[model samples]
Target: MAGVSRTVACLRFGGDDLDPDEISSVLGREPTYARRKGDVWLTPKGLRRVAKSGIWILNTDDAEPGDLDQQVAALFSGLSEDFSIWRNFARLYGGDIYTGVFLSQSNEGLSISPLTLNSIGVRGLEFGLDIYSNTDDDQKGVSEVADETLD
Candidate 1:
């Protein structure tokens, strides 16, 4: 008889908001390794599977609390080498998720705040913008304005 393997790969981003089974369904395969508690596992073929099927999900809306563009810019500004993988993960999921506000930005720079994903018991993320300027033919003007303070 041969040993059975339930090959699966699971990854938890900061918390258990996402489930491995759910991920398996998305990838249509039995995971060989499970990710949780800030650890990654790989069986003989699990690594290859994960490489082919990138991980990350986005849930954006207008009702999300906080300054959307500012938060995104801040996140980009604060990114370090340590966060390269996660940043890539975010990009793979949809850089649009973070840049939704930029996409919606008008010539006047007026747009609604973009929604962000939040896990239970996790601190709510917020953003503040110091400036939003628009330049046209050597002329610069503030297109949109908001309070610098987050809250």
Candidate 2:
């Protein structure tokens, strides 16, 4: 019989004004299933499921300008710290390829984006995130780029 290996993942919701239960609800799971790990929640099963299905959310109370900034900032922070480690760990542990989703409130409306890594320049790395505005008539998108290199 094939063994079912579970992959663990840590979900970090930045900003000082986020409710744990709300985040859990966005994940379509119970709050009890989410355990407090530092500033984020660690869920083995949920993480595995998320790896299989690329779905994520950016929880916000209101779609205000400041709220949008906070959400975007939180996403950038998470990507900078968590994504690299998560990708490396997933590969090392023989897990499937893991992708990152960023959710946030924007001036246009709710936004969702996929985090992607690319190679730019000589031996340099470029991280690109595409932000899609969730609107029917006024569809809009944005991209944030970060370039770095290893010495």
Candidate 3:
């Protein structure tokens, strides 16, 4: 098996009445992207639309694309570790950790560590995973050389 090629992790909080600034204040960190309900926003494809609800997103860009657990840990590194604070935030804004996994081959697979799961569970954050497969078969073999876990 080729295994996973890369992973990206991000923390998000969203709700109809959510205020990015308010959440930022409590988290003591700035958001990578944030918008209020009904605010004008533009898509990466250049499409323009209005936001349906307020959202605050914090991305782990500083972390290299590799282990999902390590990436998730990087996202939470400096953030509050208090369960009550996270639970309160989730109750009000519905927070979750979203992870995007890019597979190098059709049979690629990965697993999450129990320690990482425990960390997420204690924070009251919902965990989500999205897998993406490479459409081009030509690069499938490249993953063998590029897989960081092998190092």
> Roughly what TM-score does model 2 have, to 2 decimal places?
0.21
Residue 115 alpha-carbon offset, candidate 3, angstroms: 1.3
* Residue 77 lDDT, candidate 1, scale 0-100: 37
TM-score of each: 0.21, 0.21, 0.83
Model with the higher lDDT, candidate 1 or 3: 3
Which rank order by lDDT, best down to worst? 3, 1, 2
Q: Give a tens-digit lDDT track for model 1, residues 1-151.
A: 2211111111222223435455445434443333333334353334522222323322222212224444333333322323444444333432222222221122323343333233111222222223222222222111111100100
Tell me model 3's lDDT, rounded to 2 decimals: 0.71
What tens-digit string does per-residue lDDT give for candidate 2 at 33-117? 2222233333423432122211222222222232333343333342324345434423332222111222333333332233211
Say which prediction, candidate 2 or candidate 3, comes out ahead on TM-score. Answer: 3
lDDT of 3 at 140: 21
Q: Would you list the clashing residue pairs of candidate 2?
A: none
lDDT of 3 by residue, 1-151 (tens): 6558777777878888988998888777888778888998775457787887788888765222358788778878877767798888888877887776776667877888999998888888888876667775433211222211112
Look at candidate 3 and tell me the lDDT of residue 55: 80
